[model samples]
Target: EPEVTQTPSHQVTQMGQEVILRCVPISNHLYFYWYRQILGQKVEFLVSFYNNEISEKSEIFDDQFSVERPDGSNFTLKIRSTKLEDSAMYFCASSRTGRTGELFFGEGSRLTVL
Candidate 1:
């Protein structure tokens, strides 16, 4: 079975530095997303992409964050300026149809900002 893959299993960055988390979703899935979970909080939705455009995003996904499919296969999330609150496990996910379907998520890229 295919699965989402994320790089830099862990990352440490300065509070004002830029950070990029990468992911490779399942080859045939069309929907891609970025979600995050603070140390002891619930997973929160950040953004969703489809057809090369952002389909939906939450208020938490401010101007500082961005998502793109750089190479048709690799999806990336870029945080222009990392903040202490941005430290969390960023997850990349994809589903065959949409949110209602089973979403395959990567092991997650842990970001730690100081």
Candidate 2:
């Protein structure tokens, strides 16, 4: 079965640096989302994108963050300036439809801000 794939499973960066996390979502899926999990916290939705525009975004998706589907198969999240609080597992997810809310998550891009 097809699955979402993420790059650089782990990243160590200094606070205030920029980082671009990459993902290739399932080919036929439509809805895309980004979520993060801080070390002992529940998964928090960051943003959702569809049809070249943002569908939903949480407060966590502040000015420091942006997302793009630079290509037909690749989706990317760019952090303009990272912070210590940004250290977490950033998961790229996709769903066939929103009705089921079934998200298939990539292993994750672990961002470590020091």
Write down the TM-score for model 2: 0.97
Candidate 1 lDDT tens digits, 33-74: 999999889999999999999999999999999998989899
Clashing pairs in 2: none
- Cα error, residue 14 of model 1, in Å, equals 0.6
RMSD, every candidate, angstroms: 0.9, 0.7
Error of 2 at 8 (Å): 1.3
Overall local distance difference test of candidate 2: 0.94
- Per residue, candidate 2 scores C-alpha lDDT tens digits across 8-90 of 79999998899999999999989999999999899999999988889999999999999999999999999978999999999
What stretches of model 2 exceed 4 Å from their correct place? Answer: none
- In candidate 1 the C-alpha lDDT for residue 92 amounts to 96
What's each prediction's TM-score?
0.97, 0.97
Report lDDT per candidate.
0.94, 0.94
